[model samples]
Target: MDLNYSPYDFGIHNDPYPVYARLREEAPVFRNEPDDVWVLSRHADVQAALRDSATFSSVNGLRIEPAFWGPDAERFFSFVAMDPPRHTRVRGLVSRAFTHRRVQELEPRLRELARAYLDPLLDGEPFDLMTDFAGPFLADVISELVGVPEADRGEVRRLGAAIMYRDEESTDLPPEALQAIGALVGYYAELTRERARGRRDDLLSGLLDAAEGDDRLTLEEIVGVAILLVGAGIETSMLTLGNAWYAAWRHPDQRARAFDGRVADWIEETLRYDPPPQALARTTTAEVELHGTTLPAQSRVLLLIGSANRDPRVFPDPDRFDLDRDTGSSLAFGSGRHHCLGANLGRLETRIALEEIVKVVADYDIDTDGLRRIHSTNNRGFATLPTNVTARR
Candidate 1:
């Protein structure tokens, strides 16, 4: 059977697993010439590529889209698109401010934010979970962390969403996306300057003050990191929440368990079953031979994270979403040096949101017919999930 895979395809965006399964079995190192990408679809291969960053570099941003790829990728992905010692230096400074203690301290506020949005949605009427809750909640969390003023957060969220979204089958960024990027960068650049003058008790202030020895982030670097947080941090967390909600709605047994306070398990299984980051793009730094095929130097490669998570070799009965199954090997947040810096905060936000959700929401039903998904080259999740809940008295 002939293999044809394009990440830009809307059909693939809708459900790429079947294609991924075929690629893993038939072409572990599949090459899609149309998109000019080398695909690695096995658990071991993807993991190895992630760990071997030297061989599979992130110099070109993590997405294959024309707008996000190449030398300027750092403008969008920040240090995530860089190789060491640049990546090492920038991540170290950012880490100083984005400490574990800081994330841990936000729990109370996160819980409050979750309930603030969830309370009105419990009026026994159908609502779009993405619009009414997940989007706003995660946006608020990121906004609060970044010190985006309360009044400006809605526009910030809109800009962030525009940057990640794609028109069906499009390979490059649209005009609106470009406009959003410019606007977001300007906004953050001003915010960084504002904090530089007088620090506040937020991440922006922390970023301004974050230092290692005599080194510090420049104004442009801080703006880039802020944009990265808005684009990568908020989008993935928001999508993950929706993905988790949908996964539970699809499986009654898992839904029941999740409702019974097994939210962490629910998150793990959902991440394994249908992760938000379906694929990650990398650039091959040197020639390499793998799976009986040789990939040339500087070739664009896509590590199929979604496929790797479902590889039967790593997880038994991988297709099934069992809350009890161990998901320690899942690459949902990636691995190695590029392992998500915001993983702790993402988990905290999700846990708080869901924990509060399970309190007010005894059970819920999703309108499958009304479901709509966001189309992007890599990310996967709903744009609109029409839902009705059975509120708890």
Candidate 2:
């Protein structure tokens, strides 16, 4: 069977699992010549590559797009696009500010934010979950964390959305997206400067104060970290919340179980079954052989995270969204040194949002015909999910 896969293809974005299944069974090391990328579909291959970051480097960024791929990828992805000493140092500094305590401290505020955004929507009117709730909720959370003023949060969120968006089957960043990037960077740079002057009880101030002896983050690094939060933090969490909501809506039994306070399971199952990050790009450091195919040094590789999560070798009944299944092996937040630093915060946000939702929503139905999927290079989620909910009596 002939195999062809392009992450930029809208067809693939619509439903990549069937193609992923075929690639795993037929072409474990599938190559897409048009995109100039090698696709790794098997669980073992993807997991191994993630662990072996030395050979599968992230220096060129975790994307195949010309604009996002290259040595200067650090401009957009921050330390996540760096390797070795650079990555270790930058990540360590950021960690001092982005501590577990910081995330845990947000719990009370997260619940408050969840209810603040979700409460009004329970009046039984149809609302787009993405726009009405998920989008704004995450905007508030990240903005508050990073010290983005409440007045600017809406615009910041809009810019964040523009940066992640792609046209149908588009291969490169659009002009508007580029502008949005510039705007966001400028916004963060100014914010970072402000925080340096008069500190606040927020991550931005914390970042300014974060130091390793005499070593501290540079202005550009702090701005980059803030941009990374907008790019990685907001979009992923918003999409995850929408994905989980849609997943449960599709499966009645699972939906019922989720409503019965299985909110954490709901989040985990949604993450495994339909993770936001479908693929992660890596550049091969040296020649490598896998599945009888040799990948050349510097070749672009797309580790199909969505595919790996569904590999039967790792997950039984892979397509079934069962909350009972162990989802430990899922690469939803990725793995190894480059593993998502915001994983805990993302989960916490989703949990609180959904928990608040379950409290008010007795049952709900998605307007399937009206559902709109966001076209993106790496993320998979809805741009609009219209729904009507039955409020609890």
| Highest lDDT model number | 2
TM-scores of the candidates in the order shown: 0.97, 0.97
lDDT, residue 239, candidate 1:
89
Runs in model 1 deviating more than 4 A are 164-172
Model 2, residue 168: C-alpha shift (Å): 4.7
Q: What are the clash counts of all predictions, listed in order?
A: 0, 0
Candidate 1 lDDT, tens digit per residue, 274-385?
Answer: 9999899999999999988999999999999999999999999988999999999999999999999998988888888899999998898899999888887788998889
Give Cα-based local distance difference scores for all models. Answer: 0.89, 0.90
Q: Can you list the residue pairs that collide in candidate 2?
A: none
Query: After aligning candidate 2 to the native by TM-score, how far in Å is the CA of 37 from where it should be?
Result: 0.5
Give per-residue lDDT, candidate 2, residue 159: 88
